[model samples]
Target chain A: MIDAIVLRDAREHWRMLLSWAITAAALISLQLSVYPTVRESSAGLQQFIEQYPEVFKKVFRIEDYTSAPGYLGTELFSLMLPLVFIAVGAAWGSGFTAEEEEQGTADLLFALPVSRVRVMLAKGAAAFLSLTAVGIVCLGTLAVGTGWVDMSIGWRRLAAGTAVCVALGALFCALGALLGAATGRKGAALGISVGLALALFVLYSLAPLVNTFDAALPYNPFQWTLGSDPLTTAFTPGSVLKPVGVAILALAGAIAVFQRRDLRQL
Target chain B: MTTAPKVTPLRALPPAEPVLEVRGLSKWYGRTHALDALSLTVQPGEVVGFVGPNGAGKSTTLRILMGLVSPSGGTADILGQSALNGSPNVRSAVGYLPGSPALYPRPTSRECLRFLQRVRGIDCRARVAELSARLEVDLEKHIHDLSRGNKQKIALIAALMHSPRLLLLDEPTSGLDPLVQREVERVLREAAADGVGILLSSHVLSEVEALADRVVMLHQGRTVLSAAMADITGRLVQRLTFEFADTAAESWFEGVRGVAAVEAHARHVEVTVNGSQAAALDAAAKHGVIAVHSHEQRLEDVFTELIPERAA
Candidate 1:
């Protein structure tokens, strides 16, 4: 069973989550509505895609842009979907315990019968669940939109793509919360998490253009989630293992740090 | 699942371990000493008044017991368990009210209390309603909509609603009006009757004087005084000012047994007495004193007199 604290957090911040969901749903609907037009103009797209340099094609993963998987990957799964979920993770996770301390509610909060580790873990879980809810909304929108757009891509691939977003979201969520738990500063948590996420995105984006960055792609988190290309290729549990492991490590660090440190005096 | 490390129980012994106990507790932040070798204990059903001026480490001591802040040294035992790394079960048996209740404004008072009740895995609805009525708090209003005093009242309700065996309250009624403070005092008295041990810290010594069975005064993170309420009050002197119908003479109170001194000018007489005011008071009445006003010694007066000698 989920901790009541998780439900409390979700209830407290549902408006933010709903806004994120509406944006994701709207973006996906607008993207899918153009797939039929792109597929009908495939002959012109092939010549148009060929005129670009191989560097441009490789950097953007612009292969078979007229196809269902490529159209979805280039426009949806690769950047927008993952980034939206990462935003969800970062926003919800950055305030795990730091917000309570800063707002002076920590006195009443820690005064309860719950352990510090339990509260930290519950908040982390709540952040993950919020991101997962957004991912579900994306999945549901994609599943329904596929039928309308006449895209042959199956729902399993959509689920696999969304699961990748969820796993990647968990890693950033854990990192955001770890910063909050260790520093007791929400700004540090939010700024550093979003900054680190953008840095990772830029590094992964330039890997194909820069030889040195290409060498580090094996270690890049974007490689572990998006680099697998779940939409066009086979989806396997092995793809998520690395990101899940890193997420667990970050969460464990958060729990250990929060459990022993003296809270803000307030 | 991995098993946790085991340790032996604490060594020092008490005949009957108190609900809350602290021995030689100290906390230092960088170069500043927040607490230094302070000690206290509260037995079941006992109301211990924790009194001190600002920076006396009174709030620090309570925070240490509540496990919000860690002590640099010594032990704080709650329900016979160590407070430093006590299990959450210890918190279940304790209720704590901070000097100020800093709550988020988005939620109503009822919502905030309900969130806490859910976390504690207990149903405090009945207790919440009862406390709200007694304290005259509006549970329906948002926390920000309430005044500071009303917020304090809601906080008091949250702390007391769970009915814990032990309570640590720091300036529980600081922002409350006299009427509300009286209501809070009534609630605390009733809690004590149910065998709840309370460690109450306050700058308002008069409120402590009204309710505490034992009073502990802290000075510079040290216990300066600890005694029964009767013991300290016994040694304190009382002064009386009288408005007389006719001219009074200082010689009239000269032979009064308990009268320490007397001054009479025109129709006004002031007499100082130790212990009982009966003998000196009767002596002044015989001298045509029409109206009398007796002033009891305040803790601040006693504290001020002690600080000059003790701080050194």
Candidate 2:
């Protein structure tokens, strides 16, 4: 029954699927745009590395960016994942609770034999499925492009990055659902979800730039996304544990808030 | 075709068992109490009209029953289970039409019905067809494209299609045209005949006056009056109008015991009384009666008189 509801929502919201397809295509174009720059600057990059290896390495994950897998994952997962995750989450979340009241269809939904928790869970499942499908499509396209360019694909790193991004997408989707349930307004949910996502991203990014912040900043969800090489000898347990923890916490909060809330006024 | 399922389990229950029971139910939004110690019973085959003014807790009661709203302090039972404790058992057996029937804008009428049918887990295609035919709802248009009256028809279809054992309607006839209203009333009668319990809340008095067996009036989140239609109407005031020959005749009929209100016009004197026609005639004879006409009090009159006015 829950699967039916989720699948039905996906079928109904095929437009979002199309939009993600277009976005993925655009992202693929952007990734390839940087290929010529990397190829042409290799000599200069090598010279810089000789003079200041540590500085160059700190500025960019140079070894990872040289490969097609890293290049795509760098731009897409590191940059595009947050954007796509939030966009999809907001799109799905905008309709979740508020639409019931906004369209006055809540009375119809609540009058069904389904529980409120089931309703929220079903919608969250739909969002997760859609976001995961988009993530897979994006990663799959990048893998195929890497093969086309004759570059060795980092299957391990790609899988890890994609997994983390998928989780983050699911986390944001839950956040959107939570916001929707709390406000009972679509615009409010979108505003709060996107605003929080941006604020977290800024804190995670700029926190490392500050000299005093290195020890205090590793737990931020933003800090985990900065690294391009997802699978490596240097990949610490903290990188995997922190973002995953935040994602789990976010999802749990959304479900808890949604379960007890009254679904009236529609 | 041979049918093996002779008696559906739901149908085996006795008629005396209420499909819905609400007791001492109260809900407060912050400091403002929305429903206060409200209690009511709706048995099978009863059409109870829940009447009240704006902000009178009629909608709140229905919402609580539908499990859309939770009560602060009380209990409600639906089909033997606590209504607020679990996913409302009442929902499957109950069909609810809200005061404002807002539907999905993107889906066409056919698509909307299919969605609702899926949610309800019932194959309601034939039922939908039957109701649309009776209610004269056009199915090709999208919900947003339809007028307010037409949107109401789609909602009505969704609510009625399941052939639910109980119906909860809030202002069900606000936007409906008169012909559609008649059809809805007829459908309600048929549903009642089939042993369905219905609780209807509306400001439209004539629908209640015409269809309800019993009327329950609420005021400020509490039930103020509840009685059978027969009894209420019998107790209701009837206006008696008789034209007098001259002005001197008014003094002779000034303080008759049965007359509750009397208004003396230039040509005719109108008197409102609660009892026998013989007594009304006896009072009218003193005024030298020329013509006599009487109109029984409508539900509107009873409602207007019974509900105290809000203080300025």
For TM-score, the strongest prediction is 1
Worst 10 residues of 2 chain A by lDDT: A226-235
Residues A1-266, candidate 1, lDDT per residue (tens digit)?
Answer: 55678887888899999999999999999999998889899889978998899988988889888889989999998899899888888777778888888888988888777778878877877787788888889999999999988899999999999999988888888888899889999899989999999999899989999999999999998998899989988997856778878988998998888877777866
List model 2 lDDT by residue over B4-47, tens digit each.
11222343456578887888999999999888998888888888
Off by over 4 Å in 2: A33-37, A45-65, A223-228, A231-249, A264-266, B1-12, B244-267, B282-288, B309-312
Report the TM-score of candidate 2, chain B only.
0.89
The residue pairs in collision within model 2 are none
RMSD list, candidates in order: 4.2, 4.1
Segments of candidate 1 deviating more than 4 angstroms: B1-16, B240-273, B276-293, B307-312
In order, the interface RMSDs are 6.2, 7.2
lDDT of 2: 0.74
lDDT for residue B247 in candidate 1, whole number 0-100: 84
**Tens-place lDDT digits, model 1, residues B68-135:** 88889999888788877846667877899988678767889999888888787778799999999988
